[model samples]
Target: MEKVRVLVVDDSALVRKLLSAMLDSDPGIEVVGVAADPLIARDKIKQLNPDVLTLDVEMPRMDGLTFLENLMRLRPMPVVMVSSLTERGAEVTLRALEIGAVDFFTKPSSDLANCFAESAQEICAKVKMAARTRPRPYTQVQKIDVPPRLSADAVLPRSQSPGTRGSTRIIAVGASTGGTEAIRVLLEAMPPDAPPIVITQHIPAAFSGPFATRMNNCSAMRVCEARDGQPIQPGHAYIAPGGEHLLVMWDGAKHVCRLHDGPQVNRHKPSVDVLFRSTAASIGAAAIGVLLTGMGDDGARGLLEMRENGAPTLVQDEASSVVWGMPGAAWKLGAADEKLPLEDIAARLLVLAQQPIAGARRAAS
Candidate 1:
């Protein structure tokens, strides 16, 4: 198999060298060349014709976002962003994703060598994943082999099910890879009075707040990062904080958000499994589970559990997904009751939320 070719673009010489060496360490990846800035990168792109481009969020001559917009419009291709672990970096990275970058990786603040050593696997994986994205002539899709991981049971036990339907219906969502933009699109389409939404989108801790803020600006419904013990209500959407699991818990009278600090489940801190399983056990038929575009099978089992418990489930169709790993896994497991494109999911969710729950399970006595 031909290795995925990559071009590294960063204004920092150290970063470019580190990124190139890290990407090349993977046998499946080949770093074709590196450029100091967007102008040089522009010329190299025409010369190298690399399958993927790892772009620095902040550049010297032209900013990453401006270059990304120009690239997407002029010569669409798969691009991954490299961002610093800061508030401004998070904000800029989110904008890059909205501008059509495939995914992003946050650089550590200090201890560069050690941090890069630990993150090399993830960095290479994102580049490989980007290679298979749309606008790049589709080569064979790369398979990501995830090692054994903790399940939702690690955070919240499976035995604890929310046996009764709450007073209000809830919408539970999970996504990764291209999820930031996907979640934005879905939220923007939701009406102000739509059911309460709980989301887990596989992001680093620094990015979640900015992501929520960006979503709030575009979405009609109020959106904010989920707070521990926060009341669940309609006309609002709660985003799971990065590095924490967001679960819906029964508080005897009503459902509320519970943030759990625990081991990474399904190789993700805010694993979709945790959120979906929490919804399945707590909300039962009164909830709708939507698995949007993401890589890996994190949410498949939990979505299946939701279906078994009578909740309606939807997976984003492959054509509309940046990476169909999560949704495809759910489709294969027969977890989703319906598969819809990104464009149709919001309307369908609204419709499903209105359907009355009949014979829904009650809280265990």
Candidate 2:
């Protein structure tokens, strides 16, 4: 099998060396070259013609974002960002993803050597994933008309009341890789009174807060980072905070968000498996599970559990996904009740949310 070629660009000599060593250690990957700045990186790209690029957000000659914009415009290829675990880094990394970068890794603040040592597997895996990603071209901006908010009671099924103890329905969504944009497209299209949504998108600490804020600005439903013990309610979406696992649990008569600092599941802190498994256990037939565009099978088994519990489950179709690995795995496992395009997912979800939970499950089965 042909190895995936990689180019590492960073102003820090240590970071570049550490990254190269980590990536090269993997038999499936080869570090083609290293660049100290974007200017040098640009030249190396033309020369090496690498399959993937690992870019630093802050570099000497030119910033990563600016170079990324130019690269996407001129010669689009898969790129993964190397970012610091800071608020500013998080904000900038999100922008890079919007600009067509495939994925990202957050640098640890302390113990650089130990951090790289711990993240070696992750670094290699992302590079391989990046090589398989379909790079979409950056085109002219299009305007999206923000729809007006509707009452929660109006959008949901008459069989259940909104946030009435055990009477509410829940939606559990999981995504990674190209998930940020995939999620924005889905959420922005949803009606204001859609069922409460709980999401676990692979991201680093500090990034999930900003991500939720950004999603809230564009989405009809209120989006916020999940907090421990927060009540799940209609017309709202809770994003699992990064660096922790987010779970849904019954608190007396109400469903509430539970944050866990437990060991990473399937190599992810905020694993989709954790969220889907929790929902399957707590919400059962009262829930809808969605597995969106991502790079691995983290949520496949959890989604299967949801299906086995009589919950309707959906997976984004391969044609619309940036990386169809996650959804494909779920579909192969027979976990997906329906496979639909990205543009059609929200509308279908709205229809499902309006049906009696039991009826929906029966129909899906």
Candidate 3:
């Protein structure tokens, strides 16, 4: 097996030593070089051409974000950010994902021994994943710092069209990485009478409750972490809570969100696959499955199963995703029924609800 080459970039000499020692300890990984900052990294890149770069968010001479933006534009490759587990750290880390970093790890400040140990393992695994990711070329463009101004209908109204005909509709959404913000944006656009939405996002226990609370306040949809035996009612959004698998159970009369503590499928406890499989088996032809921004193939096959079972499924297009791994995998596997950019997804979703179940053809434009 070819060893994955990695370059470590950090301002702290101790961190450089620690990360170097940890990553180098992995038999599958080879530490190609080390650098203190982006300037030094640029030189090392020229010399070593490492397969992966583990970067510290805060470094002397320049912050990681600026360096990342420049690097992606000039020489795009796999870059995993090491961030502090703080509010500011999370915020910047989110920005790095959006800017095209392949993965991230919170620099363990509390238990240096355990954290660094875990980070080393995670870094090697991520480097392996990164080696397989075909990075897009860096492009220079002006930031649309301003979002398109949305209408009351676009931003605030319920998703149900006024005088809309009756159609059995269920929404299934999945995401990872910067999904918290993306979920907020997409759900907040719906009206009070929107169709029931189900979401499976990879999140931590510390964040999901707050994330659910945050979602409930933003959308008219009654968003909550799913519990066993909880009925899935119209005008509600059920989120698969962190650290548990969420599946759907249906009777001819109604459907319910079923939470389980089963072993993780595809290495994710609350997997997109488990949720999607249940959706396919129960909801069948009556659901709209969505594959959103994420970082793996966990949901791809399940979404295909959903499509085969008659649920029309959509994937987030590469142009809009933070990391297109999940959606791209689905598209490649012939699982996705359609692909749409992030901003247009909600608008198109309403149309999917109204379309006929038979002759399931996708209009990708």
Candidate 4:
């Protein structure tokens, strides 16, 4: 296969050299050009037409954000923002992601750091996959008109919803792409004692650490990345590491996490399917499964199997999704017992978790 062509842009010659060397070291990627600033980058965009562009946030001539806005407006392609690790930098990168940049990373501190950041292994992996994606024109998203905040009580689940069946006391969800903000809506409105929650959002190595920190600061529930052997406790939410799959195992009396690096399922290492399937297997008939906004069908079949194994499932309604790909695919397979708008999901899920499970099981039996 032809190598993925990359254009590296940074104001610093050292950063340019480091990025170019790092990307070119990978067998799957070839640095076609390097630009010292966005001014140079703009010229090369028309000439080289590289598959991906690695951009620095702070640069001479024009700032990266301004360049990115212009790039998306006139000629949109897949661009990865490279920013320093700062509170403000993170906030900017998150906005860039929402704006349509595919992904991001903090600029490594030095040449050695750059080498470690995109090791020969990861560079090859990311570039190859990125090259396959279609570069859509990045028209800025117009703010959609929304109705008044519907009271949380309006959307009730079907009789088969989780709380209606005793075993549904806990809810586990996984998502990617537009999930950061999506999860914030669902989690913030939820009460303090929401079901012991676990989630896996496909994200970058550096971003997940800060992402968890951000989520914890914003939501009422305690939120953090999962550690191996950490017991699955209620009122807390655990996110799996970005590049590893998180599996759940019952350790005698209590449930514990077993973070592993098994084969990638659904083209993702920290796969939603892996988490949901294991939850279905271990906590069968006792858990509620949720597959939310994402870019692909990563959780579709596993969610279906979860439903088949007697778990109730909820999927995000298409109207509220950023992409609607994952949930739409799951709904097409008839996996979701309930579909909800993003805002109401937390409220309805809480009701399901509180339903009397014993009575529902008695009826099922």
In order of listing, the candidates' clash counts read: 3, 0, 4, 5
What's the best-to-worst order under TM-score?
1, 2, 3, 4
Q: Write the per-residue lDDT of candidate 3 for residues 15-113, one digit (tens) a residue.
A: 888788777777777888999998999999989999999899988898999999999999998887887766567667666765778767777576666
- The residue ranges of model 3 lying beyond 4 angstroms of the native Cα positions read 1-15, 25-79, 83-102, 107-121, 125-167, 177-185, 213-222, 251-253, 356-365
Which digits, one per residue and each the tens of the lDDT, describe model 2 over residues 222-304?
Answer: 99999999999999999999999898888766889999887667777788888887787777777889999998888888898
Return the clash pairs for model 4, or none. 163-352, 163-355, 165-357, 166-357, 167-286
- Among the numbered candidates, top lDDT falls to 1
lDDT, model 1, position 319:
98
The list of candidate 4 runs beyond 4 A from truth reads 1-55, 61-92, 98-168, 358-365
The deviation in Å at residue 202 for candidate 2 is 1.7
Say which prediction, candidate 1 or candidate 3, comes out ahead on lDDT. Answer: 1
Question: Estimated TM-score per prediction?
Answer: 0.95, 0.88, 0.67, 0.66
Candidate 1 per-residue lDDT, tens place, 1-365, comes to 78999999988888878777777778889999999999999999999999999999898989999999999999999999999999999999998888889999988867777667677777887889999999532123233455568888899888443464675789999999899989989999999999999999999999999999999999999999999999999999999999999999888778899999989999898999999988988888888899999988999999999998888999999999999999999999999999999999999998888787845534433
Clash pairs detected, candidate 2: none
lDDT of each: 0.90, 0.85, 0.75, 0.73
Expressed as tens digits, the lDDT of each residue in 96-129 for candidate 4 is 7656676565655655553444344434444555
Off by over 4 Å in 1: 136-148, 160-162, 361-365
Worst 10 residues of 1 by lDDT: 135-144
- Lowest lDDT 10-residue stretch of candidate 4: 150-159
